[model samples]
Target: MNLRIFGWSYAVTAASLVVALLYGGWEALILCAVLGILEVSLSFDNAVVNATVLERMSEFWQKIFLTIGILIAVFGMRLVFPLLIVGITADLNPVEAVTLALERRPEDDPTSYAYLLNEAYPQIAAFGGMFLLMLFLDWVFTEREHTWLSWVERPLARIGQLNRISVVIAIVALVLLATFLADEPTVVLIAGSLGLITYLAVNGLGDFFEQAGQKQLEAFEEEDAAGPRNGSGPSQLAKATGKAGFFLFLYLEVLDAAFSFDGVIGAFAITTDPIIIALGLGLIGAMFVRSLTVFLVRKGTLADYVYLEHGAHWAIGALAAILLVGIGYHVNEVVTGLVGVAFILSALASSILRNRRLAAQGVETRKTADELAADHTSV
Candidate 1:
């Protein structure tokens, strides 16, 4: 781990802390630093998922994700999205929502932005939880030659052989939670249905475009094998331009938004200062997560740690369950963060052990081959 890979991000974080101190004094600065660290801890799995998608993209698109995509993650999701939620949920205009957010600090009053947001928590949890559950289910159901947790994943995959099993499980889980576990069944039902719909729409759109891109690439490959047909065919150019990457990028952004939903709401529990939340979480989003994605891609960490993605999706599944359960009962964010970290670290340890076994087996095979060669020479 070359710490210098994150030198720029650390510099930016330091600069942001200085600004926080200037704006809100020592207490504000301390809170902001804590929130920043919290964001990084909560979203480590997010970096793993982002790296998986990003490794397939071209260099230009990768740069676009780091530069333009960071803006969307920081400002779009962290700042404006919450306002949009408040505006819609509270029936206030955007400015009114902004006022509501800024008017009540955590210390000032109970009926502040935090309170209103908590009021909207049932629906928020439903939407985010269901969406994440679908992602996890989809991954588990898909057939793979390689698996990390074979005992758990293999059984799930076997059951998942049924057509549309992921959708079925999501709907069933939503219904059970809404009917039996949720405080507001109607809200959970509506929000969860919409969440499922949104996942289908977004995921289906990405798949459709990706299939088209794949076909285009196949056609271009055929044309290339036969020698260039024309100057540069449109299909050839389309494949080169990474239409699939564009759709995957869109999917990744939506996924990131879903992941951030809990973090945004949870931040209020720490501090209800909208300014502090924005500055702290925004810096983490901009500096840390983005850099981690790029760093993982460059270093090929996923290839080395084979089980990392599996662990991430498992952690995501756990988070989704916790969020849904929290609709009726409160679950601490610290618990959620700890669970995610445990899965990731456990997978890392397993991967290291497996690599050692494979290395020893390889050495043994080479030794046997060398002995066989020696025996043949003597004969």
Candidate 2:
């Protein structure tokens, strides 16, 4: 319980509540709190995934994520994004739509926006399903090498520079969906395309930065070998570190947005009040995520549970698939939770069994050594 982190989180949560209350009064406050809690609990896996990215970032960037990044997540996605969705789906002007969301009478049915968004399920399903499929492919391909299924990925690997091609194909598919499939598809298309493209673009940028980082490391090492080693100049070191941190932060934010997609949509299942949704899901939920990140970092949870990262990645993949299913099929939030829990449990059990076997082998080795010593003594 680092008081500083706790204090900051408390302050932010209170501030958000106060703002919501000022705008919408007591009902809004209550809804925001509920949404926040729901968002936090549902997003437990989000913190784990974020930690993977956060750990790689510099301290300054990590602070920025906790500070600035949280605001973007809370306001931009949780608050604005849904209203934007409503505006598109209902053919209303964006400002008018937002005003409607903000000023709708308390007694008025809150499900109006939810109903509109629900109508666009097909597009959501297509985007989410394809995204999940890509994740599964990456996982299966990556793990095959570890499990002696290297043969499977070999052919795929031969299609050199596939990522760029994949991006082009995804763009094409989105165009077709927007052109033909959607009723009022532009908004959905724009949102989905932006999400996908951002993922690809950020990943590409990170890879580029990584390569640049390696080059810099090599140059420094060579320089060191040639002369009496001088400590790295502060400015040069800072630049390199800043570049790495920025890349990592960007990567983390993209992943965070992906994790929040389902949670944001699912919040609709609970309530259509944007302010309540933001307060409940964004402020409370995101604070908990930040806290969870700190907890994981402090406990070194990722290092302890070797397969937990695998489980999280798998969970994310499943969620992505579920999102796609929303296009033509209805998906329950409970089903999403159960499926993720099942995969995680299976992965955890496997890890435990593997560790147990190793422990048993160690015990057998010790017993054998003891027996050999007894025999030598008798001799």
Candidate 3:
């Protein structure tokens, strides 16, 4: 085995084990192992999909993803995010809320939070319904063009300037629904607002960082051009374009979160032990994601698997809809799995058909070429 890969894996796994050991002892350790396995299994498709985006990122960005990305995944999502949700929804003090989650005994009923949220079924349905509608529209509008279902890109391409405004409007609409329709309007508003704010804040920061990265790339390219004699070098401007590439990297992580929403919620259905959830799902899932990233980088899998990215985006879109449902309506884990599995299976089938068609076309071209060559030789 490659020691470097081994070292990286061991480090993450060991850190998880140590954390579990410190917090809850042998039971925690068992929980960590089981969760890790569950995460790995559930997220294989996630890893494959993430690798599609990660492969397009720069080496420095890739390093940042492994280091900083893991921190965000753990602390931001696993530790703090859920607590933040509970605080806003339950009106519990943030620290106290988190402590409740961390220290709540398994023997005692832990269904209060889950039940509180589940009661708002109509609101959940509205959120999920609208979200699902948007997803369907996006797929129909964007994908129809690719499939040649229509001669032109429809209303989406034509409605150019209102795009950002439309997103803002959607946010406002969600805010209205959460505030007016939810049982605890303030809690719902806070929770919904946090998500929107988090998205915008992270997106804005990522944009700024990416811009700075572009400037650095330009400077580096200029230095390289001036210092070394090389043929057909990529220009400073081209290098600068890589700044945008970094934004794409950030987009992938955001996309990953969107994809994980249902899985995270579903994990709650299994067990609500925060530490156990973190150990079982977060760390282990992250390990597999890291491994998938390395595998994609090493094997150039993204280049080889043409339609895999398409499949992943479809999965992301589906998960986004499911999350909207989770906001108000209860989604079963079985349904989540079935939906994801169905989309993946369909994508795989499409890929096989596409590959076979291409192969047939290639064979036909080769046959024609051979016939022409034989005629020329006879002449």
Question: Which lDDT tens digits does candidate 1 get at residues 1-379?
Answer: 5677687778878888898899889988998898898888888888888887776566877888888888899888888888887788788898898998888656335456777788787888899899899989888887565578998888987887899989988999999999987777998899999988988887776666666766767777898899876766775666645766676677788788888877888888888878888888887555798878878778867776677777888899998998899777888888988998899999888877877887888732112323322321100
Q: Residue 158 CA error for candidate 3 (Å)?
A: 7.8
Best-to-worst ranking by TM-score: 1, 2, 3
What are the per-residue Cα lDDT tens digits for candidate 2 across 1-379?
7766567678868887898789788877777777776676567777777776676666788889988888888787677777776787778898878777765444234446666666655555555545544444444433221221234435543452365454565566566655665565666576567657666566667656655665776777787789754666445656777786787677776666666767777877767777678777777788878887877766666555555556666776677767754553568876776777766666667656655776788732122323322321100
Model 2 TM-score (2 dp): 0.74
State in Å the error of residue 6, model 1: 1.5
lDDT of 3 by residue, 254-309 (tens): 64555455555566565667777877677766766677667755765444444444
The lDDT of each candidate is: 0.79, 0.64, 0.56
In candidate 2, which residue ranges exceed 4 Å CA deviation?
1-34, 88-94, 105-111, 120-136, 143-194, 228-237, 360-379
State how far residue 47 of model 3 sits from its true place (Å): 3.1
Sort by lDDT, best first.
1, 2, 3
Question: Against the true structure, what is each candidate's TM-score?
Answer: 0.91, 0.74, 0.65
Q: What TM-score, to 2 decimals, does candidate 1 have?
A: 0.91
Evaluate model 2: give its lDDT: 0.64
